[model samples]
Target chain A: MAKKETPEVNAGSTADIAFLLLIFFLVSTTMSTDTGLSRMLPPIVPQTDDAPPVKERNVFTVLLNYKNQLLVEGEWCEVSDLREKAKEFIENPLDKPNLPEKSDVEVEFFGTYPVSKGVISLQNDRGSQYQAYLQVQNELQAAYNELRNDLAKRKFNKEFKECSDAEQDAIKKIYPQRISEAEPKNIKK
Target chain B: MAKFRKGNKGGQQKINTSSLPDIVFMLLFFFMVSTSMKEVTLLVKIKSPEATELTKLEKKSLVSYIYIGEPLSSKKYGKEPRIQLNDAFATVDDIESYIMAERESMKEADRPKMTVSIKADADTQMGTITDVKQALRKAQALKISYSARKANK
Candidate 1:
């Protein structure tokens, strides 16, 4: 019997097949880079019989309702104004009698509580929109960052990010971020 | 002139296609390097809110995503927002175990550096978010990031 010759497969079309697959991925895939607001969740505290009550003066309360209305310290406030309000409350530059109390502990380089010992307490209703909640949170954080930056600038003649580790630590000690987010309350519609 | 004309007629000219495959392969490699496959199929529809104060999550391996939004197939899941962990819809109760599992899967040194990124829809309520946050707190996943788009000026 005569030897049979195997038919040769075509290699010229392989590039076309790869090109099709490449185009499919190029069109369908989204190269999304994730950006976010970084925060640290407070550690869960064990329920004790007697936890000391936080002083009313030490608590800077912010309430957000379902209507996206903001009630800051029992007064209506706009989102745009929250940052300045929070900064004022935290810094208390005027040393108002009703504002947060100054700390007793004093360090050499940093004074005793140029920033207040008060905690910014955020309370939101269950029906409140997440957008509103985040906006408020953003404002609160901005207030802290701005204050810290200002302090860093005054102390070290540098921005917060540009300060040395010890200088940054001192600034943070003076102006610590103390935001307390309360559990969402049920509001009657 | 007659010999030259006869030679040109005897041989048909063809454009060189040897570099075509190389060019195509180069493009393929470029796409392959830039393309990252979708990690988990989204069971919920999420449109993250926009904000000016945004920080990019630098390490992909150090971050785990928790998605919160209404189910895409609303007919089956209803309109209420739900929490999604990885590829499945999870209730608040599932967060502890899910976080523990994720932590266990990582190297011991990397465990402490892990961050939970919550990607929630703009319209979702704060109640769901608070519950998730409580769950994360109990799970000891302290570091958290709320995913949002960069606001346009």
Candidate 2:
């Protein structure tokens, strides 16, 4: 009768090889942050102790609930309204500019006197969550862009909306400041 | 010739087993050496959905990502999860305001140039994620990406 043959494993050497390989991976691999989106950040506010505080109205607040519903100034509104509201508030002060009598206007923040604060307070119901907040944000940006474009057009021609596209572009390039800092009506409470 | 043939007839070839061990070890070593290290999550087990065609984001700036999870509970629904822009949680609902703030504070060199990345739970509703994306778009945030992991692994 033939003897049965048994397979042998080089246990110690195998263990050593595995250990070395594991160590190599540990040392060589780099961890990465799961990232999303690249945005051109707005310029920083000038850092000066003497600079005045931004008025409450100047800061807009848009709130969202857990259900993904949006609330602007505590009143429920569609996400679309954010842009228009932001544009309006940013473009026109809640008060003034309509008075027939010309009077000395002391600008506390910018434009005519500030009144009735317009703030967007976003209150998320633990349920409505992150994505909902993002939706609200997009609407706001669209509003800003529209307002900016409108302002730029107005600056170059004063009658800009009626001017040729090429002419408007020429004017815009010539007077960048007018287009850049057409400071929207200061948001006032 | 007959004697030589007779002697060879009873002889058997011996197979070498040592090479088998070496090959196994080499393969193990190769995989170990080539395997990459993944992110160390906070010990939270989340089962994300799978996609066949995966695109890796080597650069971080291309996406605006937000993570949605139960703030501190096991309940699947009813509970409101915490919200944050990347890592910073804001108390207000004004997402545009926040983006504007971030944009305004950013340097001229870092002008708003980014893609949005959303890393929400698979179990999370699509509406929430959409809303967040919309917000980014409203801020004129053009590029965006979603964060996903290997479905099988």
C-alpha TM-score for every candidate:
0.82, 0.33
Say which docking band candidate 1 falls in.
medium
| TM value for model 2 | 0.33
| RMSD in angstroms between candidate 2 and the native structure over all alpha carbons | 15.4
For model 2, the docking class works out as incorrect
Candidate with best DockQ: 1
Error of 2 at B131 (Å): 18
**Model 2 lDDT tens row, A129-182:** 344444554455455446546655555434544656765554333222111111
Candidate 2, residue B53: Cα displacement in angstroms equals 26
Highest lDDT scorer: 1
Model 1, B1-153: lDDT tens digits are 565565456477977776777788888888878877789999999998988878889878888999999999999999999999999999999999999999999899999999999999999998899999999999999999999998788
lDDT of each: 0.88, 0.49
Question: Residue B125 in candidate 2 has what lDDT?
Answer: 53
- RMSD of candidate 1 to the true fold? 4.6
Per-residue CA lDDT of candidate 1, range A34-107, in tens? Answer: 89898888899988989898788888999999999999999999999999999999988878888888876565
